[model samples]
Target: MTTTDAAAAQSTAEEREALRQMAAEFTRREIAPHLQEWEDAGALPRELHVKAGRAGLLGVSFPEAVGGSGGDLLDTVALQEGMFSQGASSGLMSALFTNGIACPHIAAHGSSELVDRWVRPTLAGELIGSLGITEPGGGSDVGNIATTAVRDGEEWVINGSKTFITSGTRADFVTTAVRTGGPGAGGVSLIVVPTDTPGFSVDRKLAKMGWHSSDTAELSYVDVRVPVGNLVGDENAGFWYIAEQFVVERMALAIHGYGIAERSLELTVDYCRQRSTFGEPLIKRQVVRHKLVEMRRQVEAAKAYTHAVAAQYVAAGGPNEAVIAAACMAKETACNTATYVTDQAVQLHGGTGYMHGTEVERHYRDARLLPIGGGATEVLTDLAAKLLGYTR
Candidate 1:
C-alpha cells in the first residue's frame, strides 16, 4: 500500500479505538459495579442517564445541532462493542440507550418546539423517552396500528394501548404510533405523549427472560390529548418514518447479538484456561479446544458481516430497500451466532454457567431477546423475502 493510504488506515483504526475505549470505560466504572442491584431492582437509576450524557456516551450518533456528540452510526456501533467487551449486559445497554431509539425521529423531523421538549432533553439524559410501536396483539404489523389519534381543534386526542415498550415504565414521554386516518399504513402518525397526562398510564411493568434491568411496560392511553404540534413529521407519514429507521434498529440488534456473543466467547476462553477437570485444565482437552475455536470463528464471522453491512448503510446516505434486506439478513446471522456461542459458553462453564450470578448466564438469557426484539427473526425473514422479490 502507498504511504498516505497506510497513514489513513492507521488514523481510522485509532479513531475507532478511541470511541471503543470511551464506552468501555463507562461500562467498567459506572455500570459493572451496580448492575446486579439494578437487575434486582428491575430498572436502572434515572441518574445513570445523566452520568452517561455528561460522558458523551448517550448521543454518539446524533447530530451535535440536536444535542448529540456529533458522531455517526459507526461511532454508535463502536460504543456498543466496547461496552459489551467490558461485560455490560444487553439489558443494561438497552435501558441506558433507549434515547437512541426514542429521539431519532424528533431530531430528524419534529418541529423545533417538539425537538426541544423531547429530543434534546432525552439526549442530554435529563429525561427518559421510549418508542411505542409494538402492541399486545399487533406485533410487527406497523400498518395495522389500532391506536387512534383524532384531531380535536388545536389538539389530537389519542386512545389506545402499547405493550412490550422498552423503558416505558420510566419514560417521561413516548413517541407513539397512532392511527390518524383510514385503516392502513398511510393513516398512521407518530405522536409524542407525556407520561403525566391524566389519561396516559404505565399500566404495568412486564418481566422477561432477559434484559432484567431494562424496564418494559404495558401502557394505556385513554383520551390523552396533546397539541398537534407534537406530531413527528407529517400526518399519516409514520409508517414511512418507521420503515426508514428500521435499518438502523436492525443493525443495533445485530450488534447486540454479536457483541454479547463476543463477550461470551471471551469469558468462556478464560474459564477454560483456568477451569480444571480430572487431571488438567479444560483447555487441555481436545474437544474443549475445538469448541473454543469454533466459537471464535462464528463470532468473527458475525461481527465482520454486521460491520460491513453497517458501513454500506452509512455510505448509502439514506434509506434503501436493498440495504434493509441485507440488514435483516445480518441481524439473523448475528442472532444465530449469539445463540450458539452463548449456549456453548454455558456448557463449557459447566454448573457455574447455569448459576444466576454468572456473566455467561446473563448473556445466555439476554441473547435470547435479540431474535425476538427490534423485529423478530421470523418477521424479518418474511420481510426480507418480500424485499428480495422472492414473493409477489
Candidate 2:
C-alpha cells in the first residue's frame, strides 16, 4: 500500500486496534515462551526479528515506500506497550527494536545507495543493525566521542572503540558515530560500518546486571576502511543529527521503563491477592494495599504524561525542543516510578520475588537500567534545567 493510504487506514480506531491486536498475538507467540531461556543465554535468537518483521510489527512507523506500515508515533507506541503487556521481556524489546536506533540515520540522511543496501533490508528483517554512539570514555556525551574517521582517497579509515552498544554482537551493520574533524560535537559525523569490513571486531560482549538478552558489547575499530559514501549527512554534522534523535531514543526508554513497571504491578497484584500472610491475603494488609495503590498511581501518571508528550510530538510533525524536554522529564519520572514499583513488588513477593526466574525478579534487575540508559538521570535533569534556563 501507498504511504498515504496506509497512514489514512491507521488514522481510524479500528485500524489501530487491529494493529495492536496483531502485535499482541505476535509477542505472545514469539517472545513470551523463549524469554527466560534467552535471558539466561544473554542474547535473543535473531529469528525473532524475522518473525516480528513478517508480522508487520518491525516497520509500523516508517514510510510504506521503504517497506513500512506508514503508521505514526502513536501506533508505534501502542505496539511497544502491547508487546510488553503481553509478556514480552524488556531484553527482547531492546534487541528487536535496535532497528529503531539504526535505521533512522540512513533513512534521514544517507545516499539512496545506502538506504537500498542497509535500511530496506533491515526494515525487512533480512539484516540486523545497531547504533554506536556511547564510547568507553564519553558516556552520554556525544560531542566528546574519541572515535576518529580520517578520509583517504575513496575511503575513511576508522579507529575507535564503542562500549555499551545494544545488539552490538549480532548487528550486521552499525551506524557509528565518529570524530571526523576536531574535538567536540561540531566535528562529529556518523558512518555505517559493516561487520564484514576489516578491522571491525566485536571486542567483547559485556555482561550486565540486566537486559541480558539484548547483547551489549564493546566494539573495536582498528584502521577499518569504509567508503566515503557511507557517511551519513554532511561530514561533521552528525552531532546535530544525534542530538535531534535523542528525543525519540529517550521516549523509547521511557516506554520501556513504565511498561515494565505496569507489568510488575499487574503481577504483584495477582500475587498479593493469592498469597496470604498473618492469616489473611497479603493485599489485605493496610501497608501492602497502600503500596499497591501507590504503584498504580505512579504507573498511570507516567503513562498519561508520556502519551501527552508523544501526542504533541506527532502533531508537530517534527521535534519541538519543548516536547523533547517534556519527553526527558517523562523518562525521568517513569524511571524513578518504575524503580519504586519494582522494588515494592519484590518486597511484596518476599522470597518468591527474590528467586532468579520470577518475573518480578527479572523486572527488579531490568528496572535498574532505566535511569542509567538512554541517558543518566543526572544528565537528563541537567539538560532539562538548561532547557528551562534554570541556572544557579
Candidate 3:
C-alpha cells in the first residue's frame, strides 16, 4: 500500500477505536444499570431511545445529512463490539437499535419528504420505526407475502398481518412489504404505514424464549390506506431493496452471535478463576483450563472471520457473490461458536449459570435466537451452497 493509503487505514483504525470506547462507556453507564428491570418488564422504556439519541451513539452509523453520526457498517460493528464488551445483551441491542434494521431502506430509497418525515426523526429518537417483512404464515420466503396493497386512485389499500416483528409494539410506523403486482418476488413493494392510521393495530406483544427486552409484535392491517408517495423506491422493487440488505443484516447477526460468546467467555473465565471445586480453584483443573482455551479459540476464530467478511463487504461497496457466500458462512460459523460457547459458559458456571437473571444464563438463552433470526442457519447454509455453486 502507498503512504497515503497506509495513513488512511491508520485514521480509520483510530476512529473505530474511539467509537468503540464511546459505545462501551455508554453501555456501562446507560444500559448496564437497569437491563434486568427492562428484561423483567418484557420491554424497554421509550426514554432509552431518547437517551441513546442524545448520546449520538444511537445514530452512529447513519449519514449526517439524515441526522445521523455519519459512519458505515464497520463503524457500527465496532460500536456493537464495544457495547457487548461492556455487558450489553442481545435483547438490549435489538430493543435499543431497532432503527438499524428499520430506517436503512427508507434512508437509501425513500423520497426526500419521506426521509425528513421518518428517517431523520427516527434516527434522532423522536420517532421509532420497524421493518415488517415476516408474516404470520410465511417464513423466509419474503417474496410470497400474503399482504396485499391494492392501488385505488391516490392510495394503496393494504390488508395483512405481520408476526415476529421486532420493535413492532413501539414503532411509530412500519416499512411494510406488500404485493402490488403479481405473485412473485418481482411484485413486492415497500410502503411506509403509520401505526396510528385507521385500520392499523398492534395485535399483541409476542412472548419469546429469549430477547425479552426486545418487544416483538403481531400486527394487523385491515384495509389500511396510505398515500402513493409512501412507496419506498418504485412500484415493484421491494424484493431487491430487501435483498440488498441481506448481506449486512447477516453480518450483523454474525457479530451478535460471536459478540455474546466473547462476553460469555469473559464471564466464565472470571467465574472459573474465583470458584472452588475439590478444594482448588476451577481454573487450576486441567479440564477447566482446556475448556477455556477451546472457548477462546472459537470466539477468536469467529470474530476474525466475521470481521474479515465485513471488511470485504465494505471494500466491495456491497455484496458480490463471494461476499454473500462468505457472509452466510461467517454467520453460521459465529452462530455455531455462540451456541457452543454459551452452553459451555453456563455449564462452567454450574448452578449459577442456570439461574434466571444470571448474566451467563441470559447469554445462553439469547444465543439460541441468533441461529434462528436473520435467517435460520440451515437456510443460510443452503444459500451459501447455491451461491458457491456447490449444488451442481
What TM-score would each prediction reach against the true structure? 0.97, 0.96, 0.99
lDDT of 2 at 251: 86
lDDT of 2 by residue, 304-390 (tens): 988898889888886776887788899999898889999999999999999998989998898899999888999999888888778
Measured with C-alpha atoms, the lDDT of residue 119 in candidate 3 is: 88
List of clashing residue pairs for candidate 1:
none
Query: Using alpha carbons, what is the TM-score of model 2?
Result: 0.96
Is 2 or 3 the stronger prediction by lDDT? 3
- lDDT per residue as tens, model 3, 112-228: 999999988888778888899999889898989999999999999999999999999999999999999999999999999999999999999999999999999999999999999
* Residue 358 accuracy (lDDT) in model 1: 92
The TM-score between candidate 1 and the true structure equals: 0.97
Displacement of residue 163 (Cα, Å) in model 2 is 0.4
- The numbered model that scores best in TM-score is 3
Clashing pairs in 2: none
